[model samples]
Target: MEDLKVNDGIVSETLPGSPPAGLESYGFDQKDTKRLLRKMDWHIIPFMSLIYLLCFLDRTNIGNARLDHLEQDLNLHGLQYNDCLAILFPFYIAAEIPSNMMMKRTRPSIWLTFIMFFWSVSMVGQGFVTNYSGLMATRVFLGVFEGGLFPGVNFYISQWYRRDECGLRMAMFFSAATLAGAFGGILARGIAEMSGVGGRAAWSWIFILEGLLSVVVSLGAYWAIYDYPDTATFLSPKERHEVQTRLREDTGHLSTEFDFKYVRQALTDWKIYIHMLICMAGFCPIYSFALFLPTIIKGMGYTANDAQLMSVPPYVCACFFTILASYYADKYRRRGVFLMGFQIIAIVGFALLVSSGNTAVQYTGTVFAAIGIYPQIPLGMAWNSGNIGGSLKRATGIAMQVMGGNCGGIIASYVYISRDGPRFITGHSILIGFVR
Candidate 1:
């Protein structure tokens, strides 16, 4: 037992080890420590939002770029483009566990930033891709870099926030992805309108500009983010203590070293399977429509450019609903009902899109699709993160969920094709059936 002068409210307890050399060197009490920890959220949440937003932007920007001629120019016809999408998934599923393993071993901020830099570099390289093989390689590398980010962030959040607060934080971060969906249209449209700049196509500029922005923001994130409570230097010594104390209230133990055995046990757990199934079902409607949104909107009788413009509204609508649903779910400390309700709404939205003949009616259904489908991400992630007991378990569970949902990417890629373009019966119908 060693005496630690924590906050102004001095308290002495037998610490596990003799206080670090000159442990008494700094002036901090438990109360001050608690305040600093409370302040940490301000530093954390917004940056997480930025990270996911860049990821989403890079991913779906292809949708918009395709509108400007990525597919045709690159000679990606028939299943070739679809195969490129499908390629990313297997690699993503393969890389996720290792990425999370590394995240567990190193500073999450350091690892995440490194991943972002490379993914952005790949995204930038996509602009220069001359043919199918080049594009395929870029997408594969992009998937490898971005694969672990979502799960890594989930693992990082579990390290700091209490279970109760996790839902709202997760929702807010995930909402940025939805926002990217909404805003990407506008961004792509604006960039598309540029048409030609410095001898490059507008679509090329979209990739170049957005990718560079990701690199710069990631550089900033490496500096701004605090990986965990104990290592967070921005907080007062007192706040660091408070942060650790509060997390213990939920986990019963507070340590970053995850037990590998628990990770193995989590892999065999039934709950992981249920989450995987639900996520796979949920993502069918979500990503299927999302990835092909420009095409879907164009089918409604708009020009390619106008269709790109129209894609923004539904995504914006989805973003709003995501936040609302997350806030209410957290408020009541409930998950299942909110999640089911959103799934049903998503199913209804898809039904409307598939069943309707009127252009206005079909366009309206896009709004429903956005609102109904997007919120499931936060709800599902919150459910997994809340229930998992330890760092390794949480990491494995999140990685499993992400990998499982990305399998939906394969299903979605095959579901929506240019041949089925204008009236994608097979695509939206599958989405409706699965989400229902």
Candidate 2:
């Protein structure tokens, strides 16, 4: 080893990104780091994935609830259902950057717990809303609270893992969104069957039961979720030092301290807007697909109940392929290049959906769209956060990109309006443009 140095017995290779030649000099080795990585994965990734799954489930369950007659009960008029979904984005988009900045000051466990509690409240309240205005009011609060979590998650992960290691971890976290899509269909199918139970409609049950589940999980999260590696109670003092040391060397500058300089760095970096453009491409199609998959499936001649059941397979395929893509992306250490290739897959999927009238063809398009749409989220997340240096800069950039993506969601909500249904050329064709 070339002149090794150790801080608290944590060491790295002589050059960052080189093989770890000097780890053993400080009583650390490949095996020790591997063990540490495994511990970190267990302590962090799955719980993050679980809460995010619930977060996504709560947001997109409106689609499922719609199938259970939300519109009929509310007497939603033309474009009103779409407006309800659209109502979420303004509060959601506006909150992204500020929420991340707020999280910077608070322990993530406390901050995340606080938001989760309120969003769950908003969700459960949706079940009790009796009219269009009531429904709209609940969605506004839902948007405000749910906005913080994703950017907070990206910031949290960036702090926990180095750039090279982030792709797979982000993939694992984002795969929960796909699983929620698959799982939501099954849950909705079951819940929708509970119509008229407890004097509640099936649509109401979708929100109430799911929201209550989230409420319980949120309370549990405060206890279960760990803070930084340094403060984590689960790790030994030695391992905590080791984890922090590894993280310090990964960045060009240690991101432990926040500065207004880094905040300005993120905002003024013009390249981030390019990343935001790509984010727009990735998120627009995804929100549309999630919010309307059942509607689209039902448009394909299936009953509402059957539509709920059938939405599963595409999302299952998406989860599998998303994990597969991230593994290879991490292994190869290429992001933008691999992403362009996958974008083509989604463009093809949208083309099939837009051009074909065949039911089998349309369903195939959905699978292609899901596989293509889902992977882009993690790919975009990892690519954006990995390139940004400071924790604060990463926080701002990721939130900015996500905010731009929310703009896509606004577009998505309106594109699938009922007038375009049965062969929503306007929707799928617009989606084709988005993926491209």
Candidate 3:
């Protein structure tokens, strides 16, 4: 064996008279590769999914709280409620690129775990805010801490799996948010019933209980989550070597250094902007939907409690469709087609929502919207990550996409204003234009 130095913390060895890049040269056949993938899925996916689940739950449960009279209790008149929701994205956008850089330097486990802890604390703080300004402050800090998670996690996942394998893996991770949407509806229903418990409103309990759950999960993540394949302690040294070699071959190169040159390269890349536009267009509908779904349902003449329960099915349908769409996208290795197809579906759903008057039909439109919007998020992300090469470039690219995309949250917060109640034709029409 000849020792060959490579960047990115990978230790490379060349076997005598063997192909340098082939898995066979490293004593890793198809069977060994399958086992390695299964092992990684076991260790990584569930923990990351759980983290994302809580991250989404903490950020979006405000919608559920809205039904519980959060606005009335906090004295949020006019656009104050929308302002509080809109404020999260600016800080969320500002922190992402920097956060990705920090993740690269500090390592995923430590950096991610640290951010998770602070964001959880921010979530807990939201429960105690007595006024709109106080709630806005908590939202800002919550944005700051949670900003790193999506891009950081996407970059981390790309490092573990090959391009062809990433779609389903990304879907599985992104589905946690959809699952959170479904689970959040049900969880909020139960939590909302706790009104006047310990002299606090049920909405207060939502933040506190969810935040506490995140704290426990964050504590466990330090041990449960693995770092890069090269540095992962759970795998054998031989397995680590196989991981490095396979990924190097797959990506054409690996990025070890956090250099300014890659950042400059990322800035100059037009593909980055194209992907950012795709993300921006997609996220408008998503954030609008997630933050306002319960409100929309309530506007459909359902009671507060029934609105919460009714919100569950759309998210549940979205979860199933996201995974199913990702399966085909990965299997066929055709991301753009799937993305465009889903976006069209979203547009149609919005069209239905805007043009319809029947209560049942409008509700069905939400299911179509959910199915269309949610799947494209992960698919688009995986597509962007798959095309980018090098760690720093990929990191910057992913962060850029997320940063630009989240700007849609600001737009979404305003588009679905309170006055457009019972039938948010204005918001629906605006989102339809966005998707198109």
Q: Among these predicted structures, which one has the highest TM-score? A: 2
Clashing pairs in 2: none
The C-alpha RMSD of each candidate to the native structure, in angstroms, is 8.2, 4.9, 5.8
Instruction: In model 3, state the lDDT of residue 264.
Output: 86
Scored by CA lDDT, what does every candidate get?
0.79, 0.86, 0.87
Put down candidate 1 lDDT per residue, 1-436, tens digits, no spaces.
2232211111222122222332321244545544553576678888889889999899778878888888877877778877877777778778888899889888887899899999999999988888999989999999899998888888788788766567878888888988888778888888886776787788788888899989889878788778888888886676677667767655657344667887786688777777787788877666676678888888889998899888988888888889899878766667778888998888778788888888988888889888998899888887776766677777888889888888887788778888886978778888887787
Q: Which stretches of candidate 2 lie over 4 Å from their true place?
A: 1-27
Estimate, for each residue in 1-436, the C-alpha lDDT of model 2 and write its tens digit.
Answer: 3221211111211224434433432246878877888999999999999999999999999999989989999999999999999999999999898899888878899999999999999999999999999999999999999999988898898888876678889889999998998999999999987999999999999999999999999989998888898899988999888777767766755465667787898888776788788888899999999999999999999999999999999999999989889878766666766687789889989889988999999999999989888899888777777667777888898899898888899998987989988889889998888888
lDDT of 1 at 366: 88
TM-score of 1: 0.90
Q: Evaluate residue 228 in candidate 3 and report its C-alpha lDDT on the 0 to 100 scale.
A: 93
- Superposition error at 429 for model 3 (Å): 0.6
Query: Candidate 2, after superposition: displacement of residue 386 in Å?
Result: 1.2
> Cα miss at 2, model 3 (Å)?
38
Model 2 residue 62 lDDT score: 95
Instruction: Quickly count the clashes in candidate 1.
Output: 9
Candidate 1: where are CA atoms >4 Å away? 1-38, 254-256
How well does candidate 1 score on lDDT at residue 304?
86
* Residue 360's lDDT in candidate 3: 86
